[model samples]
Target: MSAAVSTILPIEADQSKPAADPRDLLLHSIYEPDRDIQGLTARELEIIFQAYKKKDLANVPVRKAPSYSEAEQSALELWRQQVNHHMTMRISRYSMGCVSRQHKTSVSPAPRPINRTEHQVFQIPELLDLILSFAGPQVQIRAQQVSTNWRFSAISVISNPKNMETFRSLAPLPPVEYGQLLDDTTRSLPEPDSQQIEQFGLHVDHMVSWWRKLYRRRYVYFPAKLAQRDDLPNGIAQSLNELDVGQRHGDYHGSIHTVSRTTDLYWLDLSQFQINPYFDLLFSEKGRMLHRLGRWEIGLRSNATSETLVLDDSSSEKLLVQAVGSMHITNPPCRSLGIYCYDNCVFPMHGTHILLRRIRNSNGIRVAELLDALQSCAPQLLTKWVKCAEHLRRNVTETGHWVDSVWLIPGTPRFRIHLDNCDMSDEVSYATAVWTPEMARDAETLIGASLGYQAHITRTAYMSAEPPRATKEGEWLPEELFEPMKTECGRSNINWDA
Candidate 1:
């Protein structure tokens, strides 16, 4: 009656279903040997308990010398052997991961768009003018360099998004080109890239020059005939008006939005959004356009110079309540707001460079401890995806047809102030520390709450949880189990017997 044995709940058997093949279950799972039918052997269960919990099987005695049976002794030996083997495997995996990351490219400044877009579609003066107006990566730095028509296009798109189909238009994205990025070694990884980096008296002139350039029209390329969109942030509107009225004094006031991750990483970290693959309206012209934008490749580049980054004003942004209009960004007043490393096992970020931008309380000892706590959580990238599945299903269900667009939630929540504060963190700390079943469950929680991500669990854990469940036709819950669910606090006139 020790805690280990007491904590392990027994699963009810499916009396109507055929027994599953142990080999098949083993083939599909790395850790699990389906405890229902193709169940764990005595040694197999012990191996898991020892490997993860550092405990023997729930049924096994806490102390095992005199009371041990021959089978239990064998199981103990097998557990010890398996533990050694897995430890070696873990070391090997970590070594290989180090080598692999060396070859992987970190964020780099992107290739500047050509002086003029020569694609056949943009050759026409009218079409080129309109396409250039819509923002995001496609419009690029060429926006300011172009002719009057180019100026007109941006104004057109903002006034009415009906012209934004080209921006939302989807096609097979080409492989990313990494050849021509400007590598500023001084301002690179150690420097923290942009705005949130500079602190104290050492960089006053730098800030002055930077602000001077921004006020001098070198920063924003706001259009002349601008008709404000309905959803423009109030601060941005004030900034725009200041830019207009303050034009003569060379004064500029504006709200600045900062983002940390590169664009390619944006769509990949989609747990922050609710995407419905099953929406019927997605097939329609408008819905198709909106959905296509969700799939659009925004490219691989650092957000360093992307001061122009704006949320697409899609339905997804509405769900996120986007405190600030950017991805993978924690807003002010949140600890680790500008900090972007989640230490995801699957898609870990290279964040030593982000320390360059750590502003405010980041220098304090308490901040370092928080940083360590964040690292210890070591969230998997797709945990949010699995967690977001319920949200997506609920959103779609509540919306009930007539859906027009997908949604992105920018919920870059703070990590728990204390490790014990997160209920799932206890199991997740172990799971994500290496790998385990709870890693999958905690992944979703981490994504939405810690990282601005959402989506599904890994195939292994998902399959283990959902293992090709089969049931006889018309099979229902057992009568014994069903009877307990009949208890109700809410008033109901319906008969329970029926």
Candidate 2:
């Protein structure tokens, strides 16, 4: 307190009075009257304040805060708008439902009316980058609800292909709450007119019927043991004439039936496909869109890199829809499957999921006789792999044969895909492998047993659902698999010198 306040003598100074407890003092101070009380002048209070706190308060210097960038200011303003909108709705609701409208108060001057901007803020893509960077799923939904303009801008920015070549679209934000929340339209805008809806290329009148793939190719290697597992594809390698199935390369080495399909990509063709195929989408997330490669069609490197925006949810407000399709391929002989072999090749006998040949290395064995030995000895373990021309669909024959082989079967599962296999050689499934230790051990043993120097085992896995991927690989290692009992034995061990 002030010096004057401190100097005030207590009433208890009189010997005639009994000492009072703090509680009694407080009660008396609140309820009793005191006529002799004195007040300090403002000047006296200042003097006391200066004497006690001059150095701490008066001597402290003030510094200007750093200014926000245009983007930052825009982000702040967007959030401010959200708060204002939410509060306005809540107050309006309260006024209608709870407050007594009949009550009147003294006349007061009316507040000034707000003058909103003539142009919509959401029409600007540059502004969207800044706003989206600061938004979460909830905030995004709010933006979508603000007006048609905002909804279009947000979707356009996210669907734009240019973002990725620097990466936009939720890079800084948390994942969108897809499937959990529906897009809500507030501000009660009248049903959007044709011009507004056309701006976004969304169809509210007629829903699209079919989506087709731009192209398709499939590869199935021999040793398609349907009897091996009940989970295998039914129509694979069944000698169908219209289906384009059967072996060309497998005649000498091991049977490899290559199936190619060029058809309208109905959504159903995807899940029922019997072979391993490279699948991709060509949808334009911002406008007219949605396409997928036929299922069971082997993926080519050309198909790997796509420019289309991927879907996260199916929201009419956000214009999103989910697409998924995959078949069980027991032993997929296609590119990017099991051991990741190329197209048009049969697995040579022995057991080789893949053959890593450097630019200088020649084909070790005649491609014709390779699959023959293994298929004859262990037809049950026939692996489906790819054959490559020095270069196959591309002009890189020089480096075409050079591949990074990561997985094997008949041994413990390895890597992210488990490098594990189903029972059938050409089995294609729509389910993703959970990849347990048991799964890993089973594959390792089978692979460890099947391959000789000539031995090769590449287990292929196919799933139509999205493969889990992270932008930055965090702390993780492949699950540890038990070592096969005979780790160091293969047909290559049989020295021809014998």
Candidate 3:
């Protein structure tokens, strides 16, 4: 090797530029086809190739070139800046990618679907609707946790106006959810019709649950039409049509007056009207508008007076008798008649007498002579009448011992007599009075025929006495009135015991 090197001549450089191979230049220039190299001219391509070749392979020099024209130079400068910016961004992204990959390999995989069955079965919109309609608020809230899609659907369905209306009408409801539905729907609808509002009044007879909720939550307010009026709210009357007035709290004393003024409801239930003062108002000229009157029940407390005296000179009993008598004389007559007196100490015989008198006194009344004849004979039956009257006066303690008797006349159901609260003294005697159905029927026929009206009398007697004797020893004796006679040593005849 040393001998060959000693004879070596000086090395000559290759002066010819390698023949310009278009393909090679193209390939070299196309380092980044995604960049601006694709549209390069021949001159630009040559410059790029030269720059690529001359520049150190390890560190390619990036230099700013001269502009071709003013516009071109500005454009080229902007392009250079953009390209530089992009290249910097790319390098950063590439480094991040490598780091991310390294980190990802060390991490565990995310969880797969846990409830495959539920995931498959629960479709977003359908599930939301079902949950809203059938499921409770608590369940709907739980469903919302599954994903954003579920939550969105749930909110949309619940908030939709049509959906809200439908939900409001549905039953087995959750009050809170139903309330929200109603509020949202009403708000979404166009302004409520003023005419309709006026005609319908303020309060609507909605579902009972809704009414209760509204009442409890203080959501009920007087309607505008009602509020503007000087009188009580019209809605009160409207609501009264559906509501059981008896079930409501308060005196119910002034209600008759309000009812008489505001409404034309024919059938008035007076079962709950306890205040005796209201009776006059009910049967008065102003109150007689009622075409169909419900049974009137009066509960007589221990302290209650024998007679409910009205402020007017005309007694309530007298007025009621007059009203009943007048009604009987009417051509068509009242379709029904019911008088319920519960736990009342006043005798029905007295009521009947007053009714007969009113009928007899009335101008063109047909029952005068019959009622007079009955009255004339009433005294002859005084013993039985007094006994019955006394029996009626007795207070019944037990509910089971109530005596009920119904008498059928020529027409209509028999009049029913319910004798409640018959005390120990009157039980046997009262039972003896109307013991048989035939007796009851006869009594009804006599009373109806006497009154000149097709009437039935039903009488029920309630007693508080101990059960009847099963054995002789258990027989209840009236110790208060009768005691075993004791022989006196000196007297020949038994002396009356005090």
Candidate 4:
């Protein structure tokens, strides 16, 4: 049989479902109702009915010519048209099958693969530079190790000092200065305003001069009493000896230890050393009367000068304040042998313009009382208190305990503020107040009694090339600060004749 005939053979019905009706199937598949079946007269229907009644209904041809006049011509026309359409569809399907078979049998040339010669990107020096520019320093460095050609490109880029500066500038930081600040020209500037000085509660010029003296000295003197603290470290002598090594080499130094960033504020950690008494406890007597020379940390906000203050040893009970600035403080090197801990305290400045304080339980003083005492001693810090009031009030109400303190020095607007909690307990509570001009006027309301106390303020100005992160040992000061002295000493030790 022909392929078309074989394709038209009846399909086997699914046993899972009911068998289809042969009569209905024959009517739809083989007969057109209007022309071949329904339009037929009674005699034609009888013939079709007899044909469907047969056992081999699948083989029966329902196509028939009606004898009636209404269907005689119409039936012939529809039969011819239906046969043409069926033949056309079969022919078209057969043609498509032939094409598909040919496609499967036919061989097509393998697709042209890309050739390296077609696009030599690496060969182009300009293109390679463009690509390398987008790559990071480490990536470029690694690429250099890959080939001599890559080495040339990387060296050309990195060896440029401007490129090095570009990488250094990626981090937003203040300019770093080391050594000392000796600007005789600045001393000749106009004197500070008298009214402004009174508002600051101290002569601004004297304060500035005192700070300059300390900055130039690169030394802080702690009182002999603080050296007597029971908690003082025994290895202070070793640390001082190490300092002497730098000093002997004429290496500039600062009391500043570590400088790092915490959010928008920059934290400056100062070292507390006793240049006088060999052994004095730092921050002894729970910070009551002790000169309490230890590590002092301060936070700096924007528009800040690089001036940093140091707590120097003064007379029996006093710690002298001195301002030190520039690169002298940021570059303290790693000491191979020195005192790890001195009789020192950690009074950190940890705020930008606002002061945050965390309250805990160990602090014997209540939050309110501490705030009151602070207000009495430094009424000038009223602005910080106002800014911290809401948080303080909320914490006090919630925990029924207070342990936060926010204090700011008066008149020293350039001096940064840090907020911290009293170290009485582990559970810390904190708050910040919004200080308005009105709040300054309302400071009297918050203070029960004015102690009329004044804290000597000194502002030191310095910037670091970059913010140093805390090391594994929690040391955040860059080691480069100590490198100059070591470098100079190494040069001095060289034997030219040898």
lDDT string, candidate 3, 152-242, tens digits: 5555444444432322222122212000112221221134456655554533444223445421111122222222122344554445333
Q: Which predicted model would earn the best lDDT? A: 3
List candidate 2 segments past 4 Å from native: 1-498
Which window of 10 residues has the lowest lDDT sum in candidate 1? 465-474
Worst 10 residues of 3 by lDDT: 405-414
Q: What is each predicted model's overall lDDT from 0 to 1?
A: 0.26, 0.25, 0.28, 0.27
Error of 2 at 79 (Å): 65
Top model number, TM-score: 1
Across residues 89-148, which tens digit of lDDT does each residue of candidate 2 receive? 422321312223322433546956644463565457678756764563334444554555
Please report the TM-score between candidate 2 and the true structure. Answer: 0.17
User: lDDT score of model 1?
Assistant: 0.26
Write the number of the candidate with greater TM-score, choosing between 2 and 3.
Answer: 2
Using all chains and alpha carbons, the TM-scores for the candidates as numbered come to 0.18, 0.17, 0.16, 0.16
Task: Tell me the lDDT of model 4 at 393.
Answer: 28
lDDT by residue (183-258, candidate 4, tens digit) is: 3221111343546434333322333334344312232222212221222333442232233232221112244333
TM-score of 3: 0.16
Q: Which candidate would rank higher by lDDT, 2 or 3?
A: 3
